[model samples]
Target: MIDNIRENNAFEADATRDEDTMENKFLTFHLGQEDYGIEIRHVTEIIGVQKITDVPDMPDYIKGVINLRGKVIPVMDVRARFKLPPRAYDDRTCIIVVQYNGTAVGLVVDEVSEVANIARDQIEPPPRTSRGKSSRFFSGMGKMGDEVKILLDVERLLYDEERLSAGLVDQA
Candidate 1:
């Protein structure tokens, strides 16, 4: 599977190399009513509700792992990770699959909104300080038709070295 993807580097390289595709648009989604947007490039596809197999000793936000075809990927509850109130998942709920740092992850979100082409100018710096352990999760904020969308910093969102690995020490 990974080999096929690497083989397709020609197409992927073009997007990265081409100035036209360098700054492509992103698909924004909601967690706790707040809007957030990530580069569409990272997004694979949004999947519907699926059975989650709980893994022991992970952060509260790390719901569990799911078998997507053949690969076992971790799924994170965006709301829980951000310390927001838990909400019930419905038909509109989705798991946004993204390729981050070469690994595929599914971020559980409340609902996905529309796709907007927000230019570079529209993204403003995120507040210097936010009510969280790590403000680095968000790269900045973007405004669209009076609505504020938090532009996430995918790299930072994963935090650091030790936390990157899914083999977390059992919190049990």
Candidate 2:
């Protein structure tokens, strides 16, 4: 019984350590003046703002599809998706490719920041208010030094019902 108890404790410790490592790593990015982050595990790659073929009848935020190395992937303008004012794509603008539910999507942001190790203790739950269209996008708020980073939930961001309305998902 003693040996069995010791083995169980050791397994639990290892599992806790693994979760801690994953919880602290995030890929930070920018939209306008605000900073945002998403779990690094969800990010596949980052690419420059390339030529996007516009798909009619979709939401404005769904900019269009891009041929990423022969694979056609849909792209979304983070600013427009959040109901922010539109801005011209400049040199700093880039796309962050994230995979959710086996599908890859490009998120267009003002610029890519850096990968940050924000501890779980530094993150706070988002406010419970229906303030803006963008509010639903943030999973949590992380405080880093004197700044705050809005942490995004990639699954919610990609698979929201709005995506279905945009014709990205077929109704069953």
Report backbone clashes per prediction. 0, 0
For every candidate, C-alpha RMSD to the true structure in Å: 6.2, 6.4
RMSD of 1: 6.2
lDDT of 2 by residue, 1-172 (tens): 9999999999999989877777689999999889999998788999999999999999788999999999999999989888889999999999999988899999999999999999889999988775675777778999999999999988668777767678864343
Q: Worst ten-residue run, lDDT, model 1?
A: 163-172
lDDT, candidate 1, at 48 = 96
- Please give the distance, in angstroms, between residue 39's alpha carbon in candidate 1 and its true position after superposition: 1.1
Stretches > 4 Å off in candidate 1: 1-19, 22-24, 160-172
Estimated TM-score for each candidate: 0.81, 0.81
Task: State each model's CA lDDT, in order.
Answer: 0.81, 0.89
